[model samples]
Target: MKQRNILISGLSLVLMTSVSSVAMAQCTATGTAAGFAPQYAPFAVGGALNTLVSSINAANTAFLTQSTAFVGSPANPKPDQEGGGIWARGIGGEINTKNTVSSTYALGGNGSTFQPVATPLTGGVNCNTTTNLQFAGTQVGTDMARLNWNGWNVHMGSMAGYLGARARDTTAATPGINAGGSLSNSLEVPFVGAYAAATYGSFFIDGQIRWDFYQNTINDPIQNGLFNQKIDARGLAFTANAGYNFQLGNNWFIEPSAGIVISQVKVDPLRATGTLLLTGAGSIPNTTTFSNIESYLARLSVRVGTTIVSDKMIWQPFVTASVYHDFAGAAKAAYSESNNPAFEALSFPLIQGNLTANNLGTYGQFALGIAGQVAGTGWLGYLRADYRTGDRIEGYSLNGGLRYQFTPDML
Candidate 1:
């Protein structure tokens, strides 16, 4: 009877120990799941901030590069022993010899009639030269992910990145301007940004905003009359888009999207290059009151995309292409140098001509990306490249990031 009692006690002891071990293992897994949320939350927030800043930097660099190509002192006769210096700073600075036309008179010799014959001449002065400016290359990076719960999908994220652009001229070598040369220029913009998206049924919409700070450099030959200048700027931009997802059959889908972007910003001038370019005067210090300039841009785009979803693995891959058109915008100066005695005679508008808004031709973009779920969470990444047939703008973007979803239960 005592042996029977001992056996029963041993079985009970083993059962209790096994149950306790299972309980501990379960608690550990639950704790890890809870802890992951806190860790990932901060990481995601920081990433969004960084990407917003990066986007702003890219926009500013593009703006400045385009402005340089459109604005500058006109070509003039070489500063020769003649009155070339005066012309270089005066009428020559205002007129592009390449596009200028003038009339001259041929005198009738004593053997012919006294009336002078009129003649037209079309040619750039032999001493006159023109230099074109452009940003040699530009690149942008962003990281963003998405979240889904119940019937709605929400994606909000950020990224940090870099963009670089160089200024080149027609006169520069085939490879174009190096780090040096008056016409050669370059800019590096560091930034951060945030983007958010929401979807209901087949309809979805998204938007992103960015802020950036940048430093720019310009090198131009002296014949152009304007000295080399450096510019710094802080900028802000916003873009919003709407689209509809059309389910094809199986896991295939197509989405058509439309979007608009509006941007506003200003540059803090380190030098009054505008004043010098117009009047051929010496460099003037840029003051907030006198040198402040404002710029605005608005653009529209349409996109078509296709998606492939794999059920075996939690992966969704997509390809999208878009075309953008600039509709309206302007860059203007607050104060006109026309009031100043030195500039009044030249009839210089207080605003630089380049600051005046004009159409920046059209451009296109192609993007490819993949998204998937990990450990019941979500993530996404993509890359895009842009091009324009004209000399206006060109660039590329690389993006990767995370996402979170809110469900009806959470709501």
Candidate 2:
């Protein structure tokens, strides 16, 4: 009775944290910031990839950790689950994050040289701009089935979902030159993935593969409405994980795990308007295209965690932390040119650029969860809260799931 009360309290606390974290992510995603499209546009691919990988990792870890705790000790495993058993589990959850890009810009020559120039802008707009790209969604759901025979167990699962970010900036301007002008930038992507895992004795191995289809659009309402671009991309990602478990005393155990992830993305460019902000007097080009628009990213991570068993109610609580590094994968943008008269008049050369991988530079994540058997049935339940930082992609997530154990006796 008393143990049940404590378990309930813990569950309530976890739920509250989960809700708050999600709210915060949503707020960050919708916030406004400065605009630097011409420079930052090249790096949109990195931001999209980061958000996708983070969400998938969070959901997978939450369920996998809970399943490990339920397995208990191999030496004295439960007789009702000994010979062989199968369990089915389903999880529904959400993830939120923010992706930012920064760049430096100059007006090519004089910001004061605009035709029909009003008030003759002084010195021109030469400065640095950082664009905050936000992403949020709530459809991270998964279904899995585990089969165990002897001391070996295998699990298979599938995940399907979508997330999006749209950044609009109307406040950006080069002083009095282009006031009240707006920039509409948006990115939307959908993904489907599958995973498989196997456990033998105290060692575990898991792998996942995902495909992402993305569309991005950017429009500048200023400068003859030129420089608007639409991009479509497809990406493939793969990751593998391995871990070893160690038992300490009777009710405590720890596991150390490592994994690597890689992604390859290819983008198709659509017709674009002009180069930079140019007046209607400038001849706007009908179409713009980019070549060799391909990018890649790779990362490796190490994680450590421990599970604590309770004296009553068969409750188990776990905590985990991970540190990850980015190995390589930087991309470049194709050169762009416009036949608009503004290009020759202003002496603006074709713009060619590169996008450095976000790298994330050694980010870390922490998570806490609790799982247990429900009194008299073969049902198990779990709740987890996850927080991550020190990377271009920062996220907060909450997950809850139910699993049904089919004991050998029942079979």
Candidate 3:
């Protein structure tokens, strides 16, 4: 009964949020010419940029933390550094079930551009930046299986050339911006880190550190061409997770995990230029930049699965329920413009009030996955489908990856 009540309450919260957010008051055009409107058009990009930085800095997934839950594969002691064979992960850090090399891609969006602003300032802007994500990583480990409590690995990943997303804004919706404006987004992010894990019976703990590099661009095709507007954000993160597995007869097991990702992002001052998209007759030089943003993401998850093993291979199927809390919402940007000497002098302040995105607060996630490995061999792979639903947000992420280990054992 309590679970049913909680589910009902969650549904109500999302429905109410959607209605109040999408319904925007139409703008009334009063001024004859484009005064402060053209300069403020890029504000929407600021909000999207904030969302991008926040997502990149966060580490909110915990399904893989139960590294000791494999059937027929008992928890082994940490590999010996001196026992020496080929060290796939180096001598400093040994490999456990968590060590692997793989690449995966996720394609989805965080609602749409028709989202709502936190406050009604200079018009209104709705911002979100979740179109797609790509990831490839390498973690090096050891072979001696003695790593019961003393195994670690170095991990590195990158999304060097990420795909772009589209944003739509109407002067009618945002008040002072152009009447009909379209935006194109291009973003790139790459991160590198090292992680270590310790196991005590069926319980395990892991921690990682990541250094992130971010660069983004917003294009106005009708106005100035590429690179006219740019976003700059770079940072680092610390992530930690703990999980314990409980066997339920036969090959079935249940695991619960919790994790947290704390990130610090610094926005370098951006100096970019743009033209007047509203009135095609004139040119207005503008500047766009954002203040530094810091955020933290917390996640809780439980997974149930059954494993099948054979002489040559192993297969496992699992389902997971997860919840995420992302505290990274505010987007603070500063904009200014210098009018052409021959053009009309600016009558209004272009640096309007604060702009925001729908990236903060709590959300829920569910995933179904299958994993396969060649018994006694060092190769394995998995594929997963994920759905995220939350207040003012909904999206999907599909992932598949393959990994290679240095050593393996079977029943």
lDDT of each: 0.31, 0.41, 0.41
- lDDT score of residue 14 within candidate 2: 21
Comparing 1 and 3 by TM-score, which wins?
Answer: 3
Local accuracy of candidate 3 as per-residue lDDT tens digits, 199-224: 45456565666566666666664543
Give the higher-lDDT candidate: 1 or 2: 2
TM-score, predicted candidate 2 vs. hidden true structure: 0.58
The lDDT-based order of candidates, best leading, equals 3, 2, 1
Could you tell me which residue pairs clash in candidate 2?
227-274
Which stretches of candidate 3 lie above 4 Å from their native place? 1-74, 77-146, 149-181, 223-230, 277-283, 339-353, 409-411
> What's the ranking of the predictions by TM-score, best on top?
3, 2, 1
What TM-score would each prediction reach against the true structure? 0.47, 0.58, 0.64
Task: Specify the poorest-scoring 10-residue window by lDDT in model 3.
Answer: 11-20
